[model samples]
Target: MKLKLAAAMLAASLPLASMAFAQGTAPADLAMIDACLKTAEKTGGFGGACVGLVADPCIKAAKGANDDVAKWKACAARELAIWTQKTSEALKKVQAGGFTDVIQAVNDSQKTFAASRDRFCAVFDKIEPGMYPGDASYCRLRETANHSLSLIKLGAAVNEH
Candidate 1:
């Protein structure tokens, strides 16, 4: 029957759909990484080099570092430091403005954003208990970088108004 054939096709496609979702970084993030890599390759600047190197450990870990807990811990610590510094500087800049309602909103939103970042990273912990710290560190790094960029754009817009 037509109905039975349609149901079977949908069932067969479910795994493929899941596989696609599970593979690779999101498109925007991939673009950002590619940009960073290109800059590092071209200029050899510290910022670009740092961002470019963040994934090296992960790639190594994928090959075998998963078996070496120490390496993961080190990578996680390094990433957390980068995330903390970037987020702190971004928040400070956004908060340094005049005591207006917009500034207050930005401050409140930052507190909320920090909480959200923790919760979002916690999902990685939930998925792989053993790799939690490393996984969460990478998540935090990506989220913080994105947040910093957003705050920078917001600050520019506020200044423009």
Candidate 2:
């Protein structure tokens, strides 16, 4: 009877563990990104500011004019995620405190981030031909949209508090 119960528990836990893995939240990665973004966003209105700052220097070091576009773009994508994540965190923090100043910052940054992502999407639409192309532009658009949603939710959460 005990063995049967143990087997049942193990079977149940296997599905639960798989569910967690499928979610891909990676709490440690999320927390680290959140912390970095928080500090970066506080210093600059958007975390992308850090990436933008580096982009120019990286471009100048390249031997060919068009040589670094891919590299720069890849960097931009990473920075965008970091900035968006930071903005999301800031939105939550502001909601926690009901700080009016942070609200404007969050809204403004969200717009900028969205615009950047939209520009990326435009590039994607120009080239790739597919119903759901697994492209960087698509990823950026989704990230920006998610960040915007997070801001809205954070505002509501703060208002409630």
Listed per candidate, the RMSD to the true structure in angstroms reads 17.0, 13.1
- Give the C-alpha miss distance for residue 131 in model 2, angstroms: 29
- Colliding residue pairs in candidate 2: none
Q: Compared with the true structure, what per-residue lDDT tens digits does model 1 show for residues 1-161?
A: 32233223322322322232235334554555556645744674434344524545553664453465445544554444443444444455555554477666765665466557767776875566365545665566566556655665555456554
Candidates in order have lDDT scores of: 0.50, 0.45
- Among these predictions, the greatest lDDT belongs to 1
Could you tell me which 10 consecutive residues in candidate 1 have the lowest summed lDDT?
A: 9-18
Residue-wise C-alpha lDDT for candidate 2, range 43-152, written one tens digit per residue: 64444323333223433454254554455444334334433444444455654555667655654554455446555666654654333232443355245435544564
> Which run of 10 residues does model 2 get worst, by summed lDDT?
9-18
Residue pairs in clash, model 1:
none
Candidate 1: give its CA RMSD in angstroms: 17.0
Q: What TM-score would candidate 1 get against the native?
A: 0.53
